[model samples]
Target: MAASARIFSSANFNSHVKNVRFQLPCRNRQRLHLRSRQRVSKLSLGSPNQRFLSLTSFANFSPAQFSVSGGCLDRIFFGTKENSCNWNFAPTRISDGPHGGLFDDEKGPEVTVVVLGWLGSKPKHLRRYVEMYNSKGIHAVTFVASVTDVLWFDLGKKLEERIENLAQELAEWLSNSSNGRDRFLMFHTFSNTGWLAYGSILVNLRDRKDLMEKIKGCVVDSGGDPNLDPKVWAAGFTTALLKKNSSAIYPSPDKSTGPQSGNMENGLKTEPKETFSIEPWMLSTFEKLFSYLLNLPFAKEKLLRIVSCLSTDQPHCPQLYLYSSGDKVIPFQAIESFMEQQRRAGKEVWCFNFGPSPHVDHYRTFPDVYTSKLDSFLKKCLSSVASPMPS
Candidate 1:
């Protein structure tokens, strides 16, 4: 037998191992790389395995890149093409205090405000609420669902899936961080759109006792309307959509809808009857279409069931219902009935009627009263939690 060439030099060993690692599958490659790195550190040019490692090729090895943590996957899945997945969930700092900055180790976060914003909710508007929570030494996370998400899709299934994913993500986030577990959690929901998201989250957390227990309370603003009148909802949807994408969707607004105009404070506008018109023919057409879809045998019933679950499920925490008699979107009668049902069920429910505020305009209409009510409700919820925070 002829003598074979021996290629066991230090240089050869390093190069070969790199090549072999690359040739292996992603998962296996990681394990092998770790093992090989360890073995190389204790280089033994004489050992069989170590010698074999030296000969293996590493020509194709590329370092595995990790996905950026804290980047929102929801945005990528839901946002517009131009800004998709570019969204980040960085908590806006509202205060610096002794309790534990935004997040703490021993006592957990002081509070976590999860705001489920209504359709057409602008980022700046949502930020104001974040600032509010932060001022109170609490952390705020805002999740805004797209209007199209509610209007176009089969909301029952798609919306539930989206919300369930959000719930799972939230649960994981809380579990992963030391500042999460003992934190007092509350949801501030806006309008029926917000309730859809909130209710879906509750449904997902129903069986998750651990996560459910963390919820201290919830605040519902201008929401939980039981009326499933397609025409009413469709009109609201059209107005919101038009308001949001007016220039793009209705370029010549003056000719089309009399130059759409309303309160622009937070995109939560009180529609002026005399100002805008949706082309009576088109309005009637859409109304009829929506009516048919909403009237599907079990559509409205299923939605009511979900809302019922949201009211009765887990933790049984106190809830603050903020609505107005003058709000055309969600009828005052509906709010009264819902609150009455909760009270009859022995739940800690509080109702604040903003006499004439338009839909979602409760805060703008009664700023001082709104803030006071929110402050009181949050304090009550936090005080009730068994976990004591540092004074």
Candidate 2:
């Protein structure tokens, strides 16, 4: 068998991460409270026309931690030094590129890179990506959505309100910037959670052609499949939950019998499932229940329509999709088909299939290849812009 074929025979890492669960508060009412390690937020759903109220409180985390050495702290915290709202922006110097040096000194066009991170994505992880963009003289802003946000989407509850709020914030931040009108916009989204947020932003800006034209391109990693199987959805959700509540559900791995010694067939690593035992029947039952709920009259149709819009209604710009065949949480065939559809529609789409790397683990498995592809894509996006603006 070919490497990809042999790898298909082995069980995936989903089995190792499948046992964790978090008991959410009752969703019977229209309100939900989500408590995280550093913050607590309340969300209230109202009538269709009424505005939804969401309150989030941050504790002890400082904006200073995000500041790069030569970057302005104000620019890092606000969209610009003049803005007062708490949008997370972090400006950094690019020492070697064409737009190299401090923002005040850079000689190239200013590009604003907005990153939407996946569920349970850590601040450190997001910061790393931000730094990468900063190193290229691109002003980077990042938003990390909590696991509760994904839960809301999974239940098809108040998702619009949540996405609307984010879109408004982003729109306001960009519109108010001193140099907003001339700046090129690019988005890098990680996983389905990020894709949801990105889709909402697109929906909110559908009528704003001025803003839409400013968007140069977008890069989607490990997600954005138009159709997600219920089983795959459940597995991805389970993985996110495990990551969020890692301290409670995942015991420290025994070095002797954990990931290190696990089998690696056809370049794909399979973790030992003994650490977390989830019966196959349990997964089947969960999938059935989830499918039933999702297929409830009108609900599935409504959700599918929303997803269809996400896949087909995006702004006409270049898009790059990075996915892996060994991603157990998302079927690679779906991604391939979506790419094909985009091509058929005459949209500019590029894809790199990194075979055998687990979901979102492409960078880890093939760092050089991943970085090379990303650099090429970024250059292509920049080349399409006629002129670069001052930061």
Candidate 3:
């Protein structure tokens, strides 16, 4: 529960503030979205060790009227004058570490994949995926969303604007290429947080038909739940906070079944065993809390709208879904149902069910198989973009 900052402004604040810090009570960890049209930055109030905390304290606070000031907050952001915000929770490992050369080795005129990390995920968490794409000669832009991002509804406008700016930059770079090589954009999302981030990008690019057409595919890993579920949200937060110690039941992989040949009808093959690391009471409490907050008339409507847009208002491109039965966060059935829905709508869809990989850890557990499926799908997508179907 580190005091992460979500900046929504330029670097002007960086010069004005220095080493200023604030603290919220340990019991009251709220993700506040402080936004001002002219100049304002949102900061998360929590303890130094607390991560992926809660929103219980701000039941009556207003996102607009609330304001905070600090320089340590400024240390969290690295933005140019033109962009609202770029990265989230600027981790030392990604900002100044070896991963600093994240987009260095671009290979060819192949697609550029935007790797969006899950809630409470750091840039280091996505370094492997970025490296994979980089090794394949594909360019990548890695972005991680904070816990504040997924819990609230109205706070995403700045985030949306930031993503739109990124899309615009990529489009400009592609347009300026002297080689006239056909380039494309693709999204590789880790969990529901990353998937929602992708949805926000689509929302911004919806009007830019040219850019929309350039998007070739989306790779959904461990998430594609079309609708918001309280239980899933609770589980996701639990996993983010506790990491490997959470209630995830990681069963052995059923090597007999391949990703394409699994029984798609059933969800989980065996009943999950309970883990004592995260107590059952704690999970149920989180579920009850989220159920109330998410069901509020305004929050419910806004969240549902955001999710529904992902289903009907996306780019016309092929989709690849990578999920597993061992995931304790998002249910595999939800992903399969979404895939079936997309297929029925005539959109090109593909999926692979890694029988026992943990949520968002399929690549870590089964690197060879995961990369094979991803490589195959990416190739197919690039080929389709190169030779688009006759409209």
Best by TM-score: 3
Clash pairs (backbone) in predicted model 1: 18-58, 19-57, 19-58, 19-59, 20-57
Candidate 2 residue lDDT tens string, 186-233: 898888767767877787887888778778788888887777477866
Error of 1 at 310 (Å): 2.3
Pairs in steric clash, model 2: 76-89, 109-388, 109-389, 110-389
Query: In model 1, where do residues sit more than 4 Å from their true spots?
Result: 1-108, 155-157, 179-181, 244-274, 279-283, 297-302, 386-391
lDDT per residue as tens, model 1, 280-338: 43244446545655655565666666677766763678889998766655676887887
TM-score sort, best first = 3, 2, 1
**TM-score for predicted model 1 compared with the true structure:** 0.64
Q: Encode model 3's per-residue lDDT on 1-391: one tens digit a residue.
A: 4553432223443332222222432232222222322334545456544423222223232334423233222212221122222222112122233222222222335467888887667667777887676655466777665544454333345455455555566666555667666677888998997897788777767777888888888999999997668788888776665555565645445433544433233332343465453345446655765655676566677667668778898788889999987777888889999999999888999888887766887776677677767877776787654432122
- Tell me the whole-model lDDT of each prediction, alpha carbons only: 0.55, 0.56, 0.62
After superposition, which runs of candidate 3 have C-alpha atoms over 4 Å from their true positions? 1-110, 152-181, 252-278, 384-391
Please give the lDDT score for candidate 3: 0.62
Candidate 3 C-alpha error for residue 185, in Å: 0.3
**True-vs-predicted CA distance for residue 389, candidate 1, Å:** 12
